[model samples]
Target: MAQLRSVPSRSGRGRTLLAATGLVLVAAFAQAPSTALAAGGPVPAAPAADGPQLSYVVNAVPGAVETRAVARAVRAAGGSVVVAYERIGVTVAHSGAPGFAEAMRAVPGVQSAGATRTAPLRASGTTDIGRPQKVDLKQALGQARQVERARGGTAAGGEPLEPLQWDISAIRADRAAKVDDGSRRVTVAVIDTGVDDTHPDLKANFSARQSASCVGGRADTSPGAWRPWDPASDYHGTHVAGTIAAARNGVGVAGVAPGVKVAALKVSEPGTSMFYAESVVCAFVFAADHGVAVTNNSYYVDPWLFNCRGDAGQRAILDAVGRAARYAERRGVVNVAAAGNSAMDLAAPKLKDTSSPDDSTPVSRTVDPATCWDVPTQLPGTVTVAATGAKGLRSYYSNYGLGRIDVAAPGGDSTQVPDLPAKNGNVLSTMPGGEYAYLAGTSMATPHVAGVVALLRSAHPGASPQEIQWLLKLEADNPGCPASDATCTGTRHVNSHYGYGLVDALDAVRR
Candidate 1:
């Protein structure tokens, strides 16, 4: 199974409520409609610090003059600018000085400034145990031959399609294939660790020119730069890319939109397994600028499970990532994100977060949803996807919340009614080094939705991102919660666990 790293638990007190209250006061003071001060004042010098290097995101009031002023403020605060997303008025920076965020916050035209993480640069104590179990190549080849014989040896691309890919069939992708095989014009950018575009299943559809590495806030667009820096860390992104747009060449397995294009936007660092704000910010802008119609984000912006806007540090992250996403949407990209694997109610009033500040020694703290956000997923216009088992039930580990989840897809649940074919229940897709594997997580569920969006874009070439989103919710299969299930929340048509309902590739393509 594609196991997810469990968050280590630690004990601490709640200061979120107090911090949120303080944020209100700051906002009131900043927005109090004060008279303008006289111009030509001396610019404040950047503050110096005596600490280890840390990453920070600074949000400035939109415009050329305001952005330039904030960029100056970043330098004054002893931070070096890494990238300035001029369109969104957000700048990513690195700092080694103490009180860098506080000093930048005091600058004129700077809306928010905060450290991107609580840990020092390159800190390495956290570990991820989740690894993909490789499938036997000989056995897989034998199964492929058997599937070919069953199809009368006339399957497209000569090789037999993966017969055990029930996850694909469950969403009616095969049925959709009979009508439309997707278009090459549409591209789905996999914004995750990194994709192994050399995998035979992905090579045909992979767009090397559009791919890039955004591991450190800046993008490297050289050929093959978007591939995994370490082959060992390539499993997650390769698997996600396969699910979304693996080629139709009768090789390993087929993708949901096999005819569409796939691009790799490497955002995770080589050793940390963390997707920082700067890298993610670079990814959004890159995708939008490259004509990507959709993006699949299987992981959340790391270091904080919830970035509460009430806190200056967390608010900076929210502003930076939020602006990047909105910019992508404006440029015609639909962003799809996993709701998360924590199984907690995202709509809950108060929840305890013990995995925060994940780059450092994490301490538990209570957070309120109104001020805190599970970014990218909770960001405006994102299609937040929940996971479902083969039995069409919510995946046990999927986080759910009424009005929070936008749609559901087959993510596979190994514990479900075990009679289905490939009873392992985890979603199966291509892995690194020309292998295939079974993994389960809301992470597996997200690409299914992204693929369907690609199908919609392919069918309705002129449709806007908003139009495609509306069509997805309108055509979804409404599998309301079981009448006796207490864990399920909300009404039948639209519920917390199965938002809208299971995403249907056939319905999307037909529309």
Candidate 2:
């Protein structure tokens, strides 16, 4: 079965927590009007010293003077400043000190402070990471050969797997490429586990200059810093990159916007594959500073399935990431994130979140939709995406809501099979070690939209992020809510399952 987008319903302590859904990097966000802690409140209970050392982000007032003062306050509050991002006013710190977050928040110039994860730093790698189903190219190749014979024989010279890429045709990406394959100036950052630029399809268009490793909340621009930390299971970024811009070299599958370049932002924890606030914050700032046009976030911030507003710590995580995303948008970068794989209605009256504090024990709780949100995804100015199958229907595992999903695209489905040459329902793309695989999820669907967004960027280089997003929504081709399912609301043009509608790459270029 196709894996759902980030974080499959929280599993037992030792199972594969996030295969494709490790898009599970999801950061549950609560959309409250205010995240302010009680002013002049008494000190809260101290955290256990021996528990687990965690990373934290102390929001500062973005300036040299304010950041310096905040850094000193961090140390005084029993936290060590990891890196102070003056431009965005985010100071990353580490602390095992009891009441570190509460102490930091009390300091002047600190907007918010929260632990990045429930697990101790780097302790996440202890969990087993699962790999995706590999593509059966041998059988696929043989079948393509038979099709060639039916058309009079002996076809050659194309990505061997292109025959199975019904996804390209599904969104008219194939047709768009003929008119305009995209521009080399445009770059989309795959902010996920890590991207294998060494793959033949990706190397040609990989942008190393703008890539970095923000794993520990600090930006590391060392050589190949953007490459996967866990090659065994870090195939997610490479597959996603392939879908956005795998290059049309005819050696492998072509991407949605093949001429555009793709960059890597390795934010996943080395061993655990966890995505936390600090790393995510670093990615947005780095992308903004490095001139990234679009960022595809397939994962969510880990440790919490939903960061409720009532909780000061989760609120801080949401605030820090939201600041970074808005900053990137201000700097001309468009941010796109997955809508999650939980299959819950994000805009429902209330939600049952059972996977919170995922690094430790999970507790189930009912949350009001008016407050809790899917961070970065539900965060303001971020384009939230939903998954569709080969049949253009919402993927069974995709999360949806009347106002949550901004658009939909083929994320692939085992049951919604397409009738094209390739009979498989899963998405096909490049993998690490010069291989390819078939995976699915809103994680998979996100890149298809990112690719089209890149095309819009290439076509209208002078347009702002907001302008591009407007065009993206205006050009969508909505597939009305399923007749059998009453959950999908809104009109044919804008509905919960598809938002504005299925993305149209052809319109992105020609319109």
* Per-model TM against the reference: 0.88, 0.89
What lDDT score belongs to each candidate, Candidate 1 first?
0.73, 0.75
- On residues 235-289, what C-alpha lDDT tens digit does candidate 1 reach at each position? 6788888889877776877788888999999877665467778778889988998
The whole-model C-alpha lDDT of candidate 2 against the native structure comes to: 0.75
After superposing candidate 1 on the true structure, give the runs of residues whose Cα lies further than 4 Å from its correct spot: 1-49, 123-130, 143-161, 417-422
lDDT of 2 by residue, 1-511 (tens): 0121432223211112442112122122111111112233212323335534677878867776777677667666665556666777777777778888999888888878888776564334323222366766677677656666665763334456666787787888888888888999999998887889999999999999989887777677889988987777667788899999998786768899999999999887765656778878888988988889999987667666666778888888888888899989999999987887777888888988776766666788888877776676888898988888888888777788888889888887778886646676878888898888777777778899999999999999999998999999999998687899888889998999999998889999998
How many residue pairs clash in each candidate at the backbone level?
4, 17
TM for candidate 1 is: 0.88
Model 1: how far residue 510 lies from native, Å: 1.7
